[model samples]
Target chain A: MNAVVLSPVDLAIAAALIVLLAALSLRLRLGVERQLLVSAARTTVQLLLIALVLKVLFEHAHLHWVALMAAVMILAAGREVSARQKHRLAGWWGYGIGTASMFLSSFTVTVLALLAVIGNDPWYAPQYAIPLLGMVLGNTMNGIALGLDRLTLDAVQRRAVIEARLALGERWQQAIAESRHEAMRVGLIPIINAMAAAGIVSLPGMMTGQILAGAPPLEAAKYQILVMFLIAGGTGLGTLVAVSLAARRLFDERHRLRPERVGSRP
Target chain B: MPVLELDALATRHVGPLDLRIDAGECVCLQGPSGSGKSLLLRALADLDPHAGEVRLDGVACSAMPAPQWRRRVVLVAAESQWWHARVGAHFPPGFDPAQLSAVDLPPAALDWEVVRCSTGERQRLALLRALALQPAALLLDEPTGNLDAGSCAAVEALIAAYRHAHAAAVLWVSHDARQAARVAQRCLTLHDGRFMAGVPAAEAPA
Candidate 1:
């Protein structure tokens, strides 16, 4: 019961389907034909590049190589988080807060899972560590980005209400409390929906992949459950940290509502 | 000692000026639009970034926590803002119902939804909201800008009562020269970012 290997021609068949979809988009005058084709190309290039990197990484499996890879992954995720924002915190804060929170939450959660739950030898084994960290970081990145985007945009749009509260002598924390909670809720919505719909509404991608690769159904299901919990914990903690830090940055020590600190996309 | 003192207070467009208002005194500030009238009040309330010293009873603004300082020196902005659904939610517990009637609002106004209130009503409620804190100094940015003749008189009378009862120092910003003459102990006009002895309300253009 070994899994059948996919040749280049087999993948080409999948690529042909994408070309067909792009043709349909073009015929419909849906302006997305170019974006669809380009994104499909990017997916092929990016995944193939990562596959090569993973091959080298698996053969070496040294702690240093794994740490370097993790650093690169987190940095890229941080940039994505910043780019997703409509009104990002100005200067370094635009990039730093999301990056720092993702690093803290995803790294801690992945390491804990490796050391205590899975108990992999050397704990930083690239086989276990890389995939787990990638999964957690990816989810955490989305949460932090959503949380931060919501927070900064809300702070700007609700500037008058916030300052009014501030004028009435409410502390900065109290003034921005509702916006913070709202941002956190928005960030967590995706992961919550995914968890709720998993295995029933749709088979989760990781579980399907594992089962397709010939792992027993029950073993793949157990791994999928663990991954889901890890993602949930990582995302929740990351969003909480990112939103809190971003909220604090929206005001100064004098508790003034500094909407200017959150700059709009130029 | 003066209840509110500004020394070299400056924001981007206003001040680096000096002024004082003793307890129970009202100073009317007048200027054309964009002359930084609101900025001055915001600076005094520590709601905007500004330079120089502001003192309440000789206590420097920087010496106290911002919220504490703001609690003692409240600002009522020109346009009122309400975050709660019910008007009562914005008020503190044990707020005097008499204050509502003093502003000509029914006691039941508290239970009304904020969205249901008119611009003038919200303005009056905003003033009451600030007064409920019983601040020692008040920064009123066109507190009656939205009110009719009757509502404006009611607001002025209510402010006068509050000031006398609490010995609060008041800096009232207004465009109406007659209203300034009616409510202010001294009037000053901000021109080119500095205060000048105001022209007589009658002589001054409307």
Candidate 2:
């Protein structure tokens, strides 16, 4: 089986569908006509740019280029995490926690999968390493961001309760234990939902994409399962690291509650 | 010797005043709401950012680790905070069951969920919790504010017993003049950031 290729005329036919959607949105005054058009344009440009870049990187097959791209993706994800936070640590600490957690979790999981599971030739194949790391980083980043944000916000809002524990000679770690637990629970929720719904409530994107590319159903299912497991592990690890680091930042060396260290969303 | 000493301790518009409480001394502190009375207690507890010095038994609060200082000088705020769902979970290991009974709380009070506790129960239970730490000094911020007169008297007696037994320095914040006179050996009123030796005249506002 071979995947179908689209010519310029074939693309025009798809573009016509988008135009109809935008026209209907305009007629109904849904107030999203401009957003729909802009999103369509952005989707086209971004995908094409990434496709071209990936093609070059795959052809050259250089480890340095693959590493650079992964670093860039991690950095962007880190910034997104920081931006999405409602309560965040001051200065670069906000971004640092997310970036460090994602880099550590995604890198370790991706490398382990490549070396032990896939065993691609040269092991650093751009095709496998880049896509796998990207998916892992995306999920892990959201988990870290959510966990850190919840931990910080909860600490600030529950200042009296936390300090009450501290007054009773509880260590800083002991005082914030409940909040940390809650944050981790919140962070892992998305991944848990996806795991629950996958292959039953809906077909996952990767499996569908693989089937579209003519891979056997069973082969695609196997890959999807591996990817899901990697994502869950990466997200859980990242969320835990992020919450721990963020919790440490909320208190000072003196065991005093330092709500000043946490800042409202900018 | 003084058990707790405040040498010109000052916070944002609160104090630059000196005071001393000898061991076993119960000094009642009265001030209007938002008069920085709570802030002063927090400063003494080293829970707030402040200047000057607070010494506990000749050891400077700054010199010791915060947890160490806090363990010795415990501050019970007006609003008690319950971290764990259950009451017993808040206390340290080896917490004497008798402490709960002493505060007029049932021994099974420990088994009740914190959310089910009445405000007065929390206030009294918080005092018991603080006393369990065996602090060298106790800072009470309207600890019995939510309790009825009977419960208030019971809590007062419990605190007096603890102070008598441990010789803990006490700074109890109270708005009621009668309660203050009944509970404290001496009274100190806060007005314009100064701690006056006796209650201020009615014309003098805090």
Candidate 3:
């Protein structure tokens, strides 16, 4: 049987809880009341807009439409990734690296899952392709953002050490090896934690949604496992690519540690 | 022929200057703060973007790989940095602890944590680290700036010995006229982004 659908009134009741949270925040002088309200409004508006777009997307189910939606999602994720950095590489490099890395990792994994694992007819079916790409891209974006932020920040803070190493005849890769490894570890941390705490500590959001939407529990669990593996692989690959590109950008071809290449947010 | 040569090298604030240091010679550079003494040294080491050319032993810096170029021409900045916890970890593999005595450092300094070393100790150790590379040329930016009188003398003697033994070309940056005279064969002062011959050591104002 299909799951019960919630009307606008039901969602409004949920939205009221957020308003109540804002009121409590205001009373407590938490200074987040305005942000809380604004964010809640943003969530409602953004999700609803996407819902409408997805309706049109599902009805068309054309390859080009699916590809266009995927491109928009990847671009938005790229912007978010760069925006999260405290010190980003100057110029298009800051945005381009993260966008390209996420595209390579997320798109490849989603397409592979569709064609080989899920084997959906046409292999680009909106029903399977969209959600799969969304999950992988979203998680990869977070990893890449964290990884790039850590890489740039560390490069700036530890400029002296890196230069000292460089001055001592170490190759660019050798000089930046530690910072790159640290960035990778930080990027993988969220997925590692999620995997460790899955099942016993909490049901993943996707699995819960599937179960609520009337999928059998076993099927939902299987899909969750698949998605988790896909996400882990995507995040790892994306972070690796983004961090490598960013670390290279921190230096010039001459192997100089050009921290000036990374500019602080104005 | 000069072992280390700078021909019209220029950085943002320092440049278009020419100089040469023959093998086994020490040339000290002096300048007022902000007059680009450090910038000149950085350029010599190829640690900063600069215009013009530098050569070691008639070999242009651009001719070799950067790391190879740097390995033969090392820069030890005024402030030393230690990335590893233990002092010895910063040194190259198979480094002899016996060399520490030449810098007046105890053999046990190698076992000490980097944080435990005083500024002067780190400075001396940094020099030893650079010297261990057996660089054909050395770029020293106030190598003894953080040291006491005794430590300074020790560093000078060690550097002098290293130069003598290896016949390395040394470009030493110093603010103290007396130290410059003591360590350098000839001294050049950077003023308004140009190098002028410094006063003879005896004629220099005390």
Candidate 4:
């Protein structure tokens, strides 16, 4: 199969479709015309910049550059996770936990896949390592965010129940066991659903992109499966780390629930 | 000997005073709503921030781990929280069914879902749950507030029996003066952040 490259004029023609969608939203008084235009502009600029960076990265192929890029990605993902939280750990704790969890889960999983599973010629090859890391990190960050948010919220809302258990001579782990389970479950749900619906409900983005670039359908599906498994493992590990850390953070050393540590929220 | 002692206990809103309850003694604490009555109990239970020291039978609260201290000096809040779907799940393993009978609950009540339990049943069961731990001291906050007169009498009797058997110290918070008079060996009123000898004239029931 041969892939077709779109020139600038072809790209302009594709961009026209977004303008048409925005105009239709305006006509229907849907009130998202401005948002649609801003999002479209941002998507265009961000993707182009990322494309240029990736091109440069692939050409250079230095270990230090790869490490720097990975760090930047993890940091941005951590910030995204922290910003989505309603009740979060105070000060730098939320950001620190998110970044650390992603680094441990996604980075480790990606390295293992590159070196051991795929056994690529150069383990940190930007062509494979960067894209795979991006997918795993994205999913892991979401999982950590969801788990942390759920854990914090439950810690605050269910203080009475947790304390009742503590009063009953149960350890801190036993007291918040239910909440911990729930938070991890919430974190894993998205990935679980994606896994279940992968080929049938939707052709996943990575697989579709590969097939669009003229990779064989079967080859693309195999790669997609590997990516999915890596994502699932990364998410599970990240969520476990996040919820465990969060549950511990919600209490003091003596097993008292300190909702103040998460700071006050209405 | 005093089973529980608070040395100059001061929270943000109340205290900075000292008190003690001897073994087998039930001391009633009466105060208006939001006068820091619950806060005092919470502080005693090591659930709230406070200054000064709390000790159980010469063992400082700070000395023991929190879970151990909490087990010995338990606080039963007015609105008890039931986490498990089934009533029995909340209790510890090998908990005696006979304990439930002491609180006027049937043995089969253990199998009942917590959501199906009546407010009175929950109140009684919560008390039983606390007592089952064999705590040395109890910080009870309106333990029978939702109970009828007969249930209230039953709870008081059960508490009395337990206190006598174990020589446990109890800090019972109640708004009913007559109930306090009947249950407490001595009553202390929280007035303007201070513990007075008896119920204030305004708060004292006729």
Q: Using TM-score, give the best candidate's number.
A: 1
- lDDT tens digits by residue: candidate 1, B47-76: 889999999999999999999999999999
Give the Cα error of residue A57 in candidate 3, in Å.
1.2
The worst-scoring run of ten residues by lDDT in candidate 4 chain A lies at A257-266
Model 3 residue runs over 4 Å out of place are A26-31
Candidate 2, residues A107-218, lDDT tens digits: the string is: 9999999999999997999999999998999899889988998899899899988988887777889889999999999999999999999999999999999999999999
TM-score of 3: 0.97
- Candidate 3, backbone clash total: 0
Residues A166-204, candidate 1, lDDT per residue (tens digit)?
A: 999999999999999999999999999999999999999
1 or 3, greater by DockQ: 1
B108 in model 2: Cα distance from truth in Å?
Answer: 3.1
As for candidate 1, its clashing pairs are B9-B16
Model 3 steric clash pairs: none
- C-alpha-based local distance difference test score of model 3: 0.92
- For model 3, the docking class works out as high
Quote the lDDT for A50 in model 2: 96
Ranked by lDDT, the better of candidates 1 and 4 is: 1
Candidate 3 lDDT tens digits, A165-194: 999999999999999999999999999999
lDDT of 1: 0.93
- Please give the lDDT score at residue B172 for candidate 3: 91
